[model samples]
Target: MKKTRYYPFERNRYFYGKLLTVRDFESEQKYFNDKRRMMNRLLHGYGVLTGLQVIAVDDKSVSVEMGAAIDALGREIVVPSPMTLKLSMMDGFTNNEYAKNVYLCIAYDEKDKEPVHTVANSSVRSDEINDYNRVLESYRLFIREDAPDPASLPLAGITDQTVVIYQDAHVRVLQTTPRYVNPGQLFEMKLRFEKTLKAGRLSFSYEMASERIEAIHGATIMFQEPQEQLESEYEIKVLLRADSTVNVKGTVGVKEESAILKLDDCQLDLQEQAFGEIQIIKEPVRERLMSDFVKQSLEASLESPSEPCIYLAKICLIQMGPTYVIERVEQVPFGEYVFNSSVMYRLAHSAEYRDETAGQFVTKSKVKTLAPGRPPEFKVNYNPAMSELAFDVGIPVGGGGGIGGIVSGVVDIPIEPFTKINVSPFGKPSKSFFSGEIAHGLGEGNVLILTSLEETSVDSISDMLANGERVYGGSSDVFKGSEFEPEAPEVKIGTIAYPQKGTFRIGVKLQQPSEPFDVRVRWWAYSAETASSGSSSGGGDRLDEALSALREAASAGSDAE
Candidate 1:
């Protein structure tokens, strides 16, 4: 005889919001701006309060109250706590200092059939330290469109429209039970879209984007490479299961080389469900930032007297895990700026306050001039918001002076990239910087990688760890078919700002154990030290070679067996 039970799920995941109460300031102890707690707060910390809530729960459906007019329009919309009852909010990153302020997030997977908010994080961040405060103010925090703090836009045609947008996109399901979902688990699920989507215009794509569900909460939405990208028109697809809910608006547009659909307003539902058995799956989470996650120093030209500014960006593979936070991205301490104009001005400086933090730091510099101009070379600089990586725009500062942009504390990248290497407990990550050959390319022998490693030269190892990088060395274990016994993976981990000298070697190498296994290496710059005056000519055409190498390696080992 066999026994069977029914478990129901839904198609939507939510992004929560936080609330601020009168008691918050007292509890905060002024750590919101403190640099000391930034690291812990960024990774393990919570915002001023709990995460923002987007929906309310009922017996049959999840009732959502969209943020009202003038506020919460284009940004990641979040509203004040809708309930008046005395509530003891969930306490994942919560420190009592932020008393009374309610936090929201996908509070609980409103759709999980489990009994607990297992789909969400319950540990709160409570610190009034430096690094901690900086992290809080970085990535997810934005003032309401109507708020007085500035940067918010007016919602004439956009405000009320977003409410409709939320309505058309969100759904209702039971609160996700506090259960662990492993890969390959299946369950019955349901949903109710607010608007009736057209057939052809509506399409769906299912993906197992976020591979690390055991550690964080939420899911990385996946969508199809749309047919159009610049138009206002959009398509929606309802995934029956094991797929994605893609929103297609506009035609295929070229963005960063690849064909991708673009839209000012887009919402995709890449519902990642836990396969296998829930009871057996432990949430896979890496609580600390990897060596690659650090602020690199930069030297850019400044046109005016303003607070030091830096540009940073990191490419994260969206599916690494559920929840992600930028723990730290401190600017370099020194740099140099060279302007060609007759009125040459140079500015070189370090952190307003250094010698006070823990993470490895870099120096920064900037130069501006109006003399006969020439294109500038590359340089590294830190970006507060994108803590783990950095970005260097090609069109260097020119035309001399009308005031370039300057961010106050941390700044968010304009768009979240598809892939980014987050911190992990497994080993050092981002063990290499994609450069030297045609700027950056993913190739077989051309690309540097660390399959797994146990050791490196003393200087090499220290250089990486201090910078939060992942490098792989080699060992005799490659033949043993065991762990990486060569002491280091074959890959060499490094920062975009600094590249190694001499004929640098990569870390350990290994063969893929499964079919269609893939990986990526991107071009990154964190400081002036790592910047290059030259550009990469043809790099995108090499991905196949990289994959083939890993595949062949695997085949050789399998044949030996």
Candidate 2:
């Protein structure tokens, strides 16, 4: 926005006993008038102060209501009565391919009239004609291809003198409800026309960048001859999604007579979501192990091991074969041995024999055995008188001579068997394996163990990554689809100020042989407190006072001279 410029007031200088010529008097008058005009321009600013309503009278003319305005040079422009302007009589009203913009503006003109006498002498200036420059203010219509320039004045001597009352275009924007909205939210805009839409196919649509917004309903409306009266106003509605945040330039347009006319254009800001809440569902897990049996059994029994448990046991037995003496032999008794302990065991025994033929019989017998156990104590009951000693001992043939052989014999007997066992806890295992189990369980819809739980925050749904292959399960209300229907927005209708200062614009575009229509314009202006006090005679009273003071000063000067 550009800033308004400030102008200082020019005042006259006075001195004691100074010669006063006609030029000096004129300069004094100019000083006072310029001071007052400067105050008006500086304090109130230049624009229509009241009542300049414009109404279309016909296809080529319009009626303007009586009004008042201040020109750029601080001059008051008053229209005492209503007036009419013809479009064909205005400049730039010739036919063209496109429509032209017509502006009702204040035009400034000056004329040399109102003759007055400079001196009261009898014959000094007889038959002479002197006049004062009179300011004439009237309204004029300017037709152009575009809106009037704000930076450029209408003429060299004029500043904001060309106060535009109104301009005629095809369509004009009235109001927009909720100039901004979140994505996927609905908003509405209203538009007005200066002319009735012709009986034809009328389509309504909003034009914007793709993915920014979409029309849900009310995009098109058909107008028949009977419906032409209802075409003065239109409403456009559109929806913006929640996932999009880019600002959009939306243009609402109407199609008629094979031509598209823009009704309203505006920039809407989309409020983006700062963060989104999300709940993550984890996959299930399952595992199997040998320790599960033991653990379950122990749990059922309500028992647990306090320390490591180990046990070892061993037992062995051996027997000797029956012995016989050679030559003068006597019978020999059999013997047996047994052992049992935590370490190696040995057995040793002796047997006696007597000879009967040679009065002295010599017989000897011995037996020995060793194994992984304690040695055994032996007690024998034998008689020397008996020809042979008898005992309950049995021996097998083909037995090895040493303890190694005896131990080998027991090896085939399966004395004490050696076995190994491993124990491990159930369920706890590698993470990758657990994950695989979870995934497998998810597919089969079986009972699973939860491996992990996670959550994340994102600005929008677009920022989240989706992996279809991974298993997911849970419910979330954040991204759920809505079931209720969207509510319709309220209607809004009003006039908008034009880019050109102090003016309201109305537009219309229709097929050839367009219908006669009226333009409605609402406007406001700047005014000082005294001017806006609703006093109808205040301005006339002030003017009269100034004129009377001027006459009294002139009379005094004439008498002094």
Candidate 3:
């Protein structure tokens, strides 16, 4: 690189002088390009020099341009313009020797018309030891030629060049031109392919918080040969959703296949132009739990009409938010907004769970004009809106002495299950099971149940054999055991259902209850929602206080009977 340096001689006055004894004009002529005019001025007694101008500077040598000026006396004089002087030879110029110093004084002749009175001693000193070293260090290297190489001729008869493909591709983000960008400014992202890859295509995806946007700079791009060897630049523009940082994640894959070639996580830092502060902050999604208590007294009266079973039943109401609310919130392609709540029922006369409003409940109202209809069943009103119902038993299945047993069956009940199985050492083994069907009441959805058998003792055994590796199970508790297959593993069973409304059955049978075990049953329901999908029938009811009053009514009816 050609480096240039500047040295300022802050003299106010200027004059013309000529070299007295130095003889390196040939090297000096290389910079000015015209040797005739310089020599003619020297011959005419007009060559004069005063200040030094830096012409070139490098680690090896410093080239300075020496110049002359009309003296401050306001006298008009014809003199040679300053020319670049290449200073390479370094000797004892400091000792004031003529061989090393280029002394410049006004060139005078005995036959001159007017007497030229000018000092012959204005010289620019060159300290190649200290001053020149500083120039070398401070000089900015100049860029000379940067023309792009012309495209090469294609290989004869070859349609596409087969670049050798290597697995496990790694890429380095070479440069993000204009790392700090305005909200809508276009920026360039340069990625260097560190590993060779076959002819493939590159795709880009941008994520700002939870929102995902496509790269304006063509999301999908085909590879151009030889470009694989050099850094590739892609132009990207983000609008509307701007944040402190935008993650630009991408994957590269072969042109014809679905296999990914590389996964690159790149980020664009932002310099935001803040307009105002946030006025009101609210959660992206709001949730409410709506429970309906249905009195079994009505069903009992309709069925037998002899003995009435007047206990209140619990029902769950799952409904979607109003259309305007869903529209106001941002939605991603495959993203979901989930609100969850669980429902359990307890009768007033049950001793296991004492009801606070036991004796005060009323099964029949004396001032009732008409009997109210029974509450709807626990059906999922929203279709294609996924729901996951998990049943978990908190107990450690102490390692089985031998191969553990597997229990697989189905439980069919009219409503949700109310069974709790107790297999603890100190407690009585109470076997409970409940089966129910959820009439999705809509079309097109899936119900998936995933049952995983996790052994807590695995951690103890793993820690004994563990090295420096960490076991992470999505929790902060480091001592928690990782999920592992046990010698006495519990039986794993599940069923899948498609379509909106379907019947489901569940069955649980304990072989031996010596080792306390934990069981978790999860049910996933997805309901399809569209812009035209209307709200379900049973929704928008607050049930916290209503549940209490319903229990009191049932207790009062039981006491009166």
Candidate 4:
């Protein structure tokens, strides 16, 4: 059996609070003044933080101790390490009543699950408190319904009763594991709901607006005597489509309650993952047949004796994030190579990285050139936490002089220049402007830039490499000293921003060269960490085994070749 490695796919829980309307902020004399005051209040009080605990819960009310607030006993609560708290603003909805309407999104982690304390000995009845389960069963929300004023009728009325809205059931579509999904990916869509009616039979059906998506199993589900808290699941496969909204509709029927369940407008966004940019520059070397005798001997040893030249391709993986790794690389020939063939398709070898250090990221690789006729193989090791990729490349060379039928000489070419390519993210707030010394040791070389506007996958680029076609050529933006050349340079760089993140393929093509040139680049990248629990944040025991498996795969594939 062929063993495949799987990285941990983490799904974060997202709790979106209902739109909050601060009455005073909404009724300010001036719009701009209201906005300013509201923002100041929110920042000082209701912003996102970790360790916000549930202090009290009842049928009619629920209270929370904010991360920054003091507890009832007046001692400070323990605070956990904080993550990014993204809050959505609704100032654009000016026509509405309130001056500010914002929602709170907590990227909930299961590791933060702590037993919530309930107010037990209060005067409230147990049955009514048990009915509090009704509130917990639905999409949870916490409202600070403090008396609008310390003296405002105590906000009492028929409307003041916290109404528990009831229906047949409520369904929420969720990608629990990843919180987000990529186009053309197989993902699980979990539907969590409660059976409001105890003794009713319900049938469910789902449909996606786009034809590019299909349900793995039939999309219909049936429930008999469904429990109070029940969960339904479906595996959905989606294909790449232009940025558009997809509606996942679910219809349900229940006879006893005379209720018809229609879950409409359940949106599944169709967007690509954000991938970084890659630039590849190559220095080509021409093959010299030393002598007729040498050429003849080399030809006889190999089935196909084409002059195999040495190729040195320098690649830059650029992003705003800390670091990245090259997970996999493959090479295949598109057409037959004659003795005078100008270009050879070469794919850098695959490797993995484990971010062992707390802050710094390191990249290291080893390359071994086979015989004169074969292309080299690359072995890479890197840190996964900082980033997830590294490239290893080999250049084949053989002895030129022969003494007593023994080829004698050594071609020692050092690898891992490991230059950085610093580039800005593509759009505004864009990090696209790149200025640097083209090559360190070799002095100056022309810089070529191009944009991969379309979302492309590593698999697609690997196919291009395997096909041995010229894809990175044609007109390009070139910078040589103070002068600018509109014509394409020998190499090109492609940038893919977020919503387009994927395995980026960089193709380097160089025509016949009489001498050697230098290839170099350096890059830096950063991605905000969301969840910190489990293995998502670091490189663990599986890294070594994963790399070993990769090497075994490479060896088995090479042996087959």
Candidate 5:
């Protein structure tokens, strides 16, 4: 069958902290008859994590800070100033801080999950590339004045392998350069000197005092001494391995919540505005969807004879925030959120036209008897205020295809079979809450989960920028196999929870969350033999017409009324 998809961009409402807001939707009065504007019914709540760093100087001062922004969809969210840096010095400094010998310092967060670039054999270390690497910061003397002219001092020349010293009438020269170095090596050094004097010339004597040199920057340092302060140019390089690995995993679970989901009102209507249509892959047939695709595609949909009731299935949901389980109640700290809902539908052909079609072409569903059966009933499990939940209701077995036959129960059909809320012989039905009573919806499948996350970082007195990827799960599909062209997911924007640090975002491995939720869904099973008309709108339509049908089906029992 030719596939057709309708996604109405209107009549959609957004969830704001468990409360539904109309700001995301247009009113029905202004809506038009847009058939292409079908509703997106699969629930979505995925979390994308990125990071940033802000610099706060001397604990209180707004020094310079920097942050890197990444997104889960593999996009670089430009952070104008992820870090705020200040060029001024500390308060107590009065030239002494600069005039005196100075030492370089290093500091950085030791978070374990950051994506690191590993260096092999002759590759340069992280300190050699990224300037922010804390390994270059230290208390080692960075500035010295042992040279005849203070301006002649070597600062950046032999950064990791040199130091200077001076005495009253003389200066000492200690060279700690190694002839050869390898990947896995360390070095150190130490030297001393005493001064000797000569008159008239204002001269001084120099000697190689101490001769102990250690490893420096992964290589052993062998300093050569000279009679006078030796002036030499040298370079010390380091090679570090950054290829790191750790375990990563995510799961969904059930827990208790202190508060109940309070759904003030949730309305879904076909808005007159039609944004456009979408095309997706599907199973070869309905029976194949359950036999093969069901276990694989956690969220999918299929067409049926029903015009409005699309058989949306397996919409997996992942909770979007921190969740706690106390006393079996799940307490999720849900913030500004977005969710997805999806369903499948198909247009039916008239009997007059079907009779003229070639039997070699398309087939139809096996019509079953509907002599008066029971309806479904259920109970509410979780709070309605949740950003999303699962809703599935099917028919029960026995009683000669009673009222429950139309629901989640198995029915015999041929050729390209049709999917239904009816439970198969051995298949399990997804549950939900619907009608005045608590029960499952008319569909069976996974509930899609979607949400936004803010990066969390540890505060430091001297360290500035502290932005990182937001850690959250979402249900959107990311096509990673397409080599010709790439696709992007919904790019959501959010404010950082903390102030000091600059904003940053990055893509994450975003996995699905395992949280269980129950919502109500009202389903109806109509006879395929029945004609489609306003009078027989199916479930509620036959209501007023079937009082005796209701008598024998009072309490809306599955088979016993």
Candidate 6:
């Protein structure tokens, strides 16, 4: 979009004993007038300043009220009285097949006339001749097929002479719903008109290129009951079912009387199911062991321990089909070293030991010797009867004759498949130690363990899971197996209303013998007289003052010349 450029004025120069002609005087007057017009264009811009409302006069004409505006060339246009425009006289109305859009516009015009003036002879009685160029400003109103572009209007040519004030398009399609759809889904298309239809019946029909997709219901919709009272909007719904996965392509046609209007092509895709796989491991894949420093510290503090030592273990159980498998096991260290002597003695005597070479516990003696002669050994076992995994750590205590007794501490962890658990030391606040889906079906993807001090955090995590979002925290925390990615949905569905602003456009097909309609136009006009004195008008005020000074100086120079 380009605006008209006004060049700086070159006024006539005056010198001592110089002759001035009619052309020189006319040029001098033009300089001041051009300066003022240029100021109006730059400072105020141009649009309908007030009134100029378009109202429907009848089925074939509309009336425009009196108003004022400034054209693109900075010429003021004012309408003194109301005017009526007929639809039949508008351009492109006779050549249109279905409906024609009409635009009402106004343009600036001027005329020069020579008026007869009688002059009386005074003293000398000699004939003196004088000529005057009397100019009259006027305006012209007309109707056209296209609306004028305000920024690119012709200022110095006759091609485009008017600025559009209103437009009227009889019918429009508001929206189409569910552009993407699953198999056997329903689709809807909605349309709106400027006014109620006078026809008795409206029919709907569809055509599809693919044989897999078929319309089960609403294929041919008919609205015939009380046609005189039909609404401005009509919604056509079609139930389409796809026999196989494919892209559905089709078009819908609406028929009113003898006229038929075909809509744009409709595109839809059928969604397919995506499944994931589950892998079960018979043996443990990973193990987390305690540090040597933690082990030595626990044994050293057992000399005069006041409380029982507590051992923490984090275990993850994954469900495959019916049974569950222990995928990972981690041992956590106790922050402080403490032991119960009496409790340790009972665990040391009752706990069974496991032989590392046999992969099973020794049956003959409940106690197994460690390091050929030393008494310290770990006893690990899983009991199905109680559904618990127990671990016993023993240390040797010196005696009088080189025979020492074993001091052992036991930690029993409860295991319930697919359930969360909270763990803490005795007399300490409980914290979330395990979280997983309870009774989750055979389908498998990955297991995620989220440990936090607050239990309420689970609500937000559960919401994410429900929304089909992947909840894997990181590589270390996620026990990944195998998975499949789901397909994206194809169509979106919604509704839209009329008189909207922005780049979104609506299309429509009108019935035969289309009715005349009128549109309400909204315009913003800025002028120096109507401008307010406020913070918002500060910049405008400064520009107005500067332009006023330039116009005054040009007027003074033109008068002196």
Best by TM-score: 2
* Candidate 1: tens digits of C-alpha lDDT, residues 167-224: 1211111111112222333332221121111111233223222222221222222233
The alpha-carbon RMSD values of the candidates against the true structure, listed in the order shown, are: 32.0, 62.5, 36.9, 35.3, 41.7, 45.0
lDDT of 4 by residue, 374-482 (tens): 4457766576666544667765444221111111111122122222333336421211222221111111221112222111234575467663222212222223342
> Higher TM-score: candidate 1 or 4?
4
Q: How well is each residue in 1-561 modelled by candidate 2, as lDDT tens digits?
A: 122222244455678987878788777667776666666644454555666555666544656677666655555666779877664565654444223233444443445666665555435766664545454444443444333322133121111111111123433332222223444455443332222232122333332222343445434432222333434334433432322443443333222232233323322222221111111112111121223333453222222122101100000111112311111101100000112222222222211221225344334443222222324334344556754443432232222212111111100001111132222265322110000000110111111111101122233542454421221112112223552111111111122233223222212111112123221111111112222232355565654454454445434333111
lDDT of model 3, residue 129: 20
- For model 3, state the Cα shift of residue 4 in Å: 3.0
Tens digits of lDDT, candidate 5, 1-561? 212333333564436575543443334322432221222112222211122222223322232222222211111223334333221243221332211211111121122343444444126564543222222211110111222221122111212223333222122322232222222233223233222211011121222121122223433222333436322222222222211121211111111121111112321121122111111113222344345433533223322111111000111111223321111111111111222222111123345465665343322223222222345433323333442333334343334323432322212211121233334367643222111221112222321111222223343631354332223222222323543111222222211111122111112221222232211111223332221222323565454444334334323332110
Tell me model 2's lDDT, rounded to 2 decimals: 0.32
- Greater lDDT among 3 and 6 belongs to 6
Off by over 4 Å in 1: 1-377, 386-455, 459-485, 489-509, 512-561
lDDT of 3 by residue, 44-135 (tens): 21112333233223322333333332211111123234432222233211222111112111211112233333333224333222211111
Question: What's the C-alpha lDDT at position 93 in model 1?
Answer: 35
Worst 10 residues of 6 by lDDT: 447-456
Model 3 Cα displacement at 301 (Å)?
Answer: 95
Q: What is the lDDT of residue 293 in candidate 6?
A: 23
Q: Which wins on lDDT, candidate 1 or candidate 2? A: 2
- Top candidate on lDDT is 6
lDDT for predicted candidate 4 compared with the true structure: 0.26
Off by over 4 Å in 6: 1-5, 13-18, 85-98, 114-133, 148-561
Worst 10 residues of 5 by lDDT: 307-316
Give one digit per residue, the lDDT tens place, for model 6 in 325-380: 33332322111111235656776655543233334433322322121124566887
The lDDT for every candidate, in the order shown, is 0.24, 0.32, 0.26, 0.26, 0.24, 0.35
Q: Mark the 10 consecutive residues where model 2 has the least summed lDDT.
A: 432-441
